[model samples]
Target: MIEGRVWKYGDDVNTDVIFPGKYTYQPLEPAEMAEHAMENLDSSFAKEVKKGDVIVAGYNFGCGSSREQAATCLKAAGIAAVIAKSFSRIFFRNAINNGLPVIELEDGVDDMEKGDTVSIDFEAGTVTHKGNAYHFPALPKEVLAILNDGGLIPHVRKQLGRE
Candidate 1:
């Protein structure tokens, strides 16, 4: 079970808004990048986000650019998961590769408001918020494996027992 307060956002929240391009040349680490997470959209996001806080957004979330830092920043910012109506294809892959679960729901965020306490059961593919339950197709075993081991790197590490 994953539980957290909802931090709602709108559609087409691009990678640039997520981490900004000015800092891209700096090669800042995840922690450094996290300090700027959502700074453009919400300046206080990085400092205010508590561990396990959930991010809910509208369709086409994570659109624009294919930078992996977008996902890295969110994970480093301690986001529990991102439940959106849709996501850019590369962003979706980057998120899963970096250990952040991105869930798609057609109307899930419509009923959610900022700061709504939400709970998700990946095994059951159910999301509960404000007494409303949203269900999705069960996550595949491979996806679960990557998430369970904390992204692809750790999952691969556990598989080989070493690099």
Candidate 2:
């Protein structure tokens, strides 16, 4: 179970806006990458985001180029999870591989507002907002394992007995 404060947004939030294309070429550390998260979409986001904050967005969230940094930057920015009405397939996979939990809540987005407190139970596949619970398909065990181990690379390293 993960609970956090919401940082809401609308549909079609692309990779560039999630983590601007200009800084993509730089050899930025995770913290540095976080500093630029949502600079394009919400200039105040990087500065105001707190650890364990959640992002609640509308349909086609993450609809843009398949840059892994889009997911990476959000995770680095201390986003515990992203709850959207829908997601770009590539971005969805990238998020899981990067240890960022992306939950698809087709309903209840309208009920949630910025700064609202929300709770997500991955095991039960429910998102509780303001005492109401919305459901989504539970994540598969394999995907959960990857997220639990902190992304694909870390999971693989552990599987190979390297960590």
Candidate 3:
């Protein structure tokens, strides 16, 4: 179960607002990037987010530049998963490749409000909040394999008996 205080955002929450373009020149360190995550949008996000917290957004979350930092920062920031109405193709793949679980909810994240305690059952593809159950498409086993092992590299290492 993935549970935390819900951080709600509207549609088209792009990467620039996510990681910010001003810091694009900086080193691609997860910690550094995380410190600036949502700085361009929600000023207190980086400082306030808790481990296992879920990012609930509208359509096309991560809809800007295809920088992998956008995904890595969120992962490093301790976001358990990103549940959105839709995601940009590249962002979605980057997130999966980096071990950040991203969920696409057709019904939108309307039932939950910011600061509301929310929980998601990834295996069951259901989100529960205040007795409300929101269903999302179940992630494929292959995708879960990567996330389970904490991203692709670790999973590959495990498969090859190297880690």
Candidate 4:
């Protein structure tokens, strides 16, 4: 179960805005990457985002170059999960690989607004907000394991008993 305050956005939020391209090549750490998360779209996000906050967005939520930094920065910024109407194919996979819980809530997303409190039960595929429950397909067990282990690399390491 993941519960948090919603940080909402609209469609087609690309990588450049999520994490500015200016610092992409720099050898910044996770914390540094977080400092710039959503800097272009929402300048206050990095400074104000709290741990376990959820991002609710519209269709094509991550629609841009497959920069892994996009997902990495959001995770480092303490985004617990992202609920969107749809996602770009590459960004969807990248999010999973980064241990970010992303759900495709085709309906009821519009009912949510910024600063609204939401709760997600990944195993149940439900996003609860303001006494309303929105449903999406539950993620598979393998994917859940990866997220549980904090991402693909960690999950693989644990499976091989090398953690």
Q: TM-score: which candidate is best?
A: 2
lDDT of 1: 0.90
Better candidate number, 2 or 4, judged by lDDT: 2
**Residue-wise lDDT of candidate 4 within 87-142, one digit each (tens)?**
99888888998999889997788889989999998767788998989889977788
Candidate 4: regions farther than 4 A off: none
Residue 27, candidate 2: Cα error in Å is 0.6
TM-score, predicted candidate 4 vs. hidden true structure: 0.94
Model 4 scores worst on lDDT over the 10 consecutive residues at 138-147
Candidate 1's residue-wise lDDT over 96-129, tens digit each? 9999998998766888988899999988889998
Model 4, backbone clash pairs (residues 3+ apart or across chains), number: 0
Candidate 3 on 8-52: residue-level lDDT in tens? 998899999898887887776798889988888999899999898
The worst-scoring run of ten residues by lDDT in candidate 1 lies at 136-145
What are the candidates' C-alpha RMSDs?
1.4, 1.1, 1.6, 1.3
Ten residues in a row with the worst lDDT in model 3? 105-114
Any residue pairs clashing in model 4, and if so which?
none
lDDT of each: 0.90, 0.91, 0.87, 0.90
